[model samples]
Target: MGKQMFSKPPIQKSHELLLPTTKESCWILVFLLAFGVSSIHGDDGKIDFRYHHYLDLSRVLNDTAASCHEISRVYSVGKSVEGRDLWVIEFSDNPGVHEPGEPEFRYVGNMHGNEAVGREILVYLVQYLCSGYQAGDARIRRLIDQTRIHIMPSMNPDGFERAATLGPDSPRTSTSWGSYGRLNSERIDLNRNFPDMLPVWLLQEESQRRNHHVEIPEWYWDTLVAPETLSVILWSLSQPFVLAGSLHGGSVVVSYPFDSCGLRKVMRSYSEAPDDALFRKLAKVYVDGHRKMGKCGQVEPCNARNFTCKGGMTNGAEWYCVPGGMQDFSYLVTNCLEMTFELSCDKYPGEDELQTYWEDNKEALLSYMEAVHTGIKGFVRDGSGKGVANATISVEGVDHDVTTGELNIFDIKTYFLIPQRLTETTGDCSFRGLTG
Candidate 1:
């Protein structure tokens, strides 16, 4: 089929908050005025359900690093359109420095600011990993020692503030940004604002190859890659990331790549990746760790009648298309295999239900990081048992390959490094290091 103009579905209305059905009062949201708020917190001074506003989140990051400078480092990778710093907390013994042969993984939260659960969970992750390390937890220590993991709690801080500022019972906007803060400052959906791969795939010829970024025309300059998107794009490219999964709200399932088919929207279809099996394994590791995310039989399937994602994992396009999604862009452009995690059914869950979320997802969060070690990762030696630095590693029949670093070790996600055989003798290897 020829290229079709992408007219995606309208934004969902489920993000609006509902009033509590209490006997004392029906929980009427009395908005005295939208403009006058002493602070972003609730009347009690904190949005308790473990949720923190932008200021508090930043404070938590600083405090975490302040308390544990030995194993943690806090820095801003980029800022939002509204000039909010995109804070990233890296957890490692050698936090700021990148060691060769060590693979990196990242978890990004609050891509949609209204989806507050992910943002809160990611903030909590900093405390969980850091305090766990201090407590001499073997698992936490092992993870920190082995992987260079980063948690970006709020990629869209401006949107978060906007969402929190609006509060509940506010009228929804239809044109661009949702009722709350779903989009960035300019009201563009960040998830739908990337250099879409489907167009590049169809346009690129074998002789004139171009990357997802390089292939874009001048017409797509401002809208295609927003400041927030560019911030994450550059930050992600700077690291040798093996995996980068984002936490989104509005559903409860693990969604893998190919978010858009690059064609007109259809009711149902599946879009498989070159490394579908590896993606499945990675998603399963996460879903299985969650107490309820993996069980697909009766009580909680992704969609009871129409679908059955055996292990609570769905291909992004098959489930529903999200054009210009970060997941697809990360995979198609770089070595990182990005996945989209729909963490909750409610875009903005109430505060009282926050602890339940932490308990539900904490184990899954830790286990997903362990997946970076699932594929063949270790040192590559030569014939005489010497470390072979910069040697290309390829498996027969696989299109991609990874090279060993100065440390003589190569670590790669199986998503792109799908090797059927053991040696690089059969074919030429193209992917040298997961670094951009």
Candidate 2:
């Protein structure tokens, strides 16, 4: 039970058929009304301000590393668009080294500068884990000992600093001009800037077979490669991450992939991921922790317009289609299962509200991190008990099968760093394709 830090660096699916009808669609309509009202409706400036500016956050993280030197280290993954170093705080028995049979977990916060709730919680999370370990908490000791945990408290520093409604160059927010502050500095919505998952041709120059299609008027996206998004993509690629989540705001729900609805459609649509059952359990951990997230009634959403995210979860696109989102990109291109957590109803909660928000979410955060260990993992061995190298590992209900790597341990795309957890009750006897 201990803690340390280095320089600076940075770092779901479920199958269900609950189609939206005209009646259920009312939630969407009421939500739009509530959202619009919330935009204009301020908290009477009664809220205080206590969030960290970019430099202050750096100092805090650096201090944490200096204190927990043994169990922690600080390093820089990459820089932001405006050249601010994207610092990462690592907590593990051994930081920066890949351990066999160990799963890597990551939490990214404040992808949207204005949506500051996530960034704040992540800051607390680092301290929470560090302090717990120092206090000799067994849970903290086991988590850091068994898994690699990476936390990026602020992914969009520039956007947070911008203090504007939208990206300066964005036409979408040209007239609205309030405090949307949702896009990155270049004015592109980072959430909507990742490579789209819908099967369609990019610019004619890019073919179907190419791995990265980054050359669009905006690279098949409306915005070019904002440095923040690029930094995250590279960091995830460099690790053997199995489970990840990003913190967001403006809603109080946990959204799982695919963020897009295959193609562009205005209304709600359905797209089930390969591992729908697995994803559901992962989300339920958080929703169940925060019973309010799964509840709808007095003061909360009983219908579409006012905090109406039923059961506290929904498919990203089914709520509404958003192409090129980060959640979908993580699953389609990497060995990670990432979910976007809309932590609070307010994109940026006031200073006094920060602690209360943390109280509500801290348990869910800790639980979700622990949930990574609940999934299935083991070597696929032979009759003589010899290791089986390069053996195919397939799950029947799931779309893709994984192939074993060097140790013949059915590692899947792990060599390439491709992704989850298996539970005893739910995971037992699952995946029919472990063949001869």
Best by lDDT: 1
C-alpha local distance difference test of each model: 0.64, 0.62
Cα RMSD for candidate 1? Answer: 15.4
Clashes of each: 0, 34
Candidate 1: how many backbone clashes? 0
Candidate 2 local lDDT, 1-436, one digit each (tens):
0111212222200101111011110000000000000011111121222577888889878888877877888888877767887878999988867665667799998777777888888888787777777777777788889878999988878777764333323223433223355666567677876667554322321453432212112333333667777667667555656789999876788888777877446457766776565666677777766636777663355346444446788888778887878877767655477898888766655577887877677778877887766535555344444444434444444553343334223433222122242322221112322111
Question: Model 1: residues >4 Å from true position, as ranges?
Answer: 1-49, 166-177, 202-224, 263-267, 297-310, 378-394, 400-436
lDDT agreement of model 2 with the native: 0.62
lDDT of 2 at 397: 42
* Clashes (candidate 2): 34
Error of 1 at 202 (Å): 4.4
